[model samples]
Target: MSFEILFLVIYFVAMAGIGVWAMKRGKQDAEGFLLGGRSLGPGVTALRLQSSSMSGYMFIGAGSMGYTQGYFSMWYALGDLGGGILNLSVLGRRMRKLSQILGSITSIEYLEHRYPSKWIRLIAAPVALFCMFFYVLAQFIAGGRGLEMVSGVSFPVALAIAIGVIVLYTFLGGYLAVAYTDFVQAIIMVVGMVWILVATLMAVGGFTKGNEAVGEINPNLLTMWGADLGYQGQWGVILGALLVFSIGYMGWPHVVVSHMAMKKPSVARTAGVYSLIFNLLFIPGPYLVGMFALILLPNLANPETAIFEVADAVLPTFAVGIVMAAIMAAIMSTADALLLQAGTIASQDIYARFINRKMNDAQMVWVSRITVLALAIIGYAIAAFDPPAVAAVVIFSTTVLGSAFVPSYICAVWWKKANAVGAISSMIAGTLVSVLWQVSGAPDATGIDPMVTGILASTAAMIIGSLASQKSHPVPEHIGRALDETAKIGPIPKKMLIDQDALLASQAEMAGRHE
Candidate 1:
């Protein structure tokens, strides 16, 4: 068999094996299926978070941007770092506590509790569905693209295979499967990226020659920061792009679900540290790889295809197949996570909470699986449109999530005075305003990013209206209890690790409550 086909078969078997293992645990019920019974360890959480966070965009979109933009792309990496710091320091602990308090199996569940409005939950369900649906589609498209690019196969056949693998693993194991697969995929992604990065250094003849070649192409590309050769770029534009992309980190359904899946909320502290370090290495990958391409493959027509160009240039055929599988790993890791989260939220928060409260765990799990299949199909259909541009789709999805949910999520953890009236109002206003801002051709609109405007406006509405309508919600007792629980951050020993018996006991309590 061809190396590409061989690699594909190996990857499929590995993913399926993970799914089978995870399904054993998933048989427990909704919590098992969605949050892995809140038993994910620090390493698993860190790997899953990083893999899901670095999506198709990082490999294809960010790579393409770096090819043209050079060191300016590093701003995106820095911005993501900044966002991670914010998530861990400001929102991370609180989110863990809150999810436990509200019995929130998903992010939208937390949203419904904070707002206490069925209407807000209703609005959020479809929005989450839409964003994740497109997000999954983008991943499938990238997966198919990777297959075609590596194997020289037709796009349709490649797409079908990509979608098939993702659905098989995801439908079988749910979040449990996604988490373990994410661990493996994260390692593969890092290795593949580092391999290409090393080859890029060699291809460009070293850092100094790389800089010289970039300068030869366009002096601006060699600088630490600047706009595009044409007027399409700016320092502000780059900063805005990076900020919008990364600030939404905590709000994306997949990423936030990682937070919810933590076995111990304190594990987040350790996971946060590891994630920060790993992201630093991975985020700069595209920028460096793309810059190398500028030096070696300047005439390459499609900048997004530059990573593959470099891979084919340096690696042997089998190695190229491995790299292709690794890229698909990145794509599937994110797609499965998002698909599971969306399906979970749809069944539990939307269908169970609003549409069908009497639905049993078995029924909910079935619905969640169906939702996953439906979303995968939708994403595949969208990817069939074959958008060559990566930045646009990525930016649009992040912008919507960031604008709509980020502010409310922040308030839920921080602002005690925040109420349902404020939460519901802000989500609608922020999402609508952001959508309108984009519709108004605001991506090119001067200095401010659309998110900046939408977030600011929605925040004002939430704060002012919350203050004005003090009687709208009495803060849940669980919120206070969870906060009190978190306030007692126990002293860390010289060697710290979770006590499994105590962890299992706590999980049993959560399960009992669910029952």
Candidate 2:
């Protein structure tokens, strides 16, 4: 067999083996399947979170942005350099402690407990699922495109193959499998990008020659402000792009869930440092490689394929396969996390909580598997319909999640008066504004990112709704105590620790006492 095919076969087999191993090793409960029993270590947690956060956007979508917008695209990298650090510092340890204290296996469940409102769970779960579906769809599209380019297969067949593998591993092993495989993928993605970047620079006679070549085509390609595309030069678009990668990292349930799953809350402290280093190494390579592609393959039609084309042209066959697999790794790492998140939301939040509250561990696992498969099929169908560019879909979905959840999430942690009314109103307003902004033509119409609109609207709603409902819906004393305890930088008292059953009983007892 050809080297590319051989390498891919090995990679796929290795991934499958990990899935089988995880299925055997991991716990069988819903918490285990969805969050790996909250036992992931620092390295694995950091890499997995980084891999999922970066996604195929770094390889394909970001590269395309570099090729199209030149140095302007570096704004994304600049914004993302410390995203993981910011995320962990702001919400990681506290969220982890709080999730366990409240018996929250999913982010939606956490929101429900934090706000003490069924309405919050009801609205938040659906909105999260909606945003995540689009995110997963984008990853599916990236997978299809990468496989079609490397394997010489039809997009549909490649898409099916991608979905099938992702579903199998995610269904069988769940988060543990996803996390371990993401560790491997994270290494591959970074190594491949760094290798490609160094080789491409060497081939083109270093930075000076590279810049000269690009300068010959159009100096505009090398500019900071970039080509004038109506709103491209505007501060809003630039700041929006920055915010989407920086602060927006906090709102992603898939990424945020990582904070809830680490072996210990202290893992976030170390993991944050590791993730920052990984991002620093991994983020810039794709953009630089894309810049190199401008000098090497100027006439290439689809700039998204710049990385793949460069790999094929510059590297040996075996190396090419490895790089291609890394590209696939980027896609799968994100796809698996998004798939798992969607499945967890559906099975845990929707199925067990709303559909049938009596689901046992075994039944929940099976339901989660089925839900993952179903979501994969739906995402595959959406991908097949020729969606927007990978970066666009990713950014749009990130913004939707950020606007809808970030305000509520921040308030849940810091604001004692953030009640169900404020949380629900913020979610509804953010989601509605983001959707309407997109439907109205996004930045082209307003020269500001849709995320900005959604965030502003959501923030306003939170303030107004909370004040208006303060008397009617005061913060629960138990939730307030839990929040204060989690906010402290130490272990929760053993006496205060409780499992799901005990948590429910305590809540019931508290209600009785209050009544």
On lDDT, the leading prediction is: 2
Per-model C-alpha RMSD: 5.2, 5.7
Which parts of model 1 are misplaced by more than 4 Å? 14-45, 173-181, 224-239, 254-268, 386-388, 471-515
Off by over 4 Å in 2: 14-45, 90-103, 172-181, 229-233, 257-268, 483-515
RMSD of 2: 5.7
lDDT, candidate 2, 208-283, per-residue tens: 8887887777777777667444434588788877878776767877544433333344554556667787778778
Task: Please give the lDDT score at residue 189 for candidate 2.
Answer: 76
Per-residue alpha-carbon lDDT of candidate 1 for residues 4-96, written as tens digits (9 for 90 to 100): 778878776776676666665544566655655256677776876687667888888878878877877776678778877776553554565
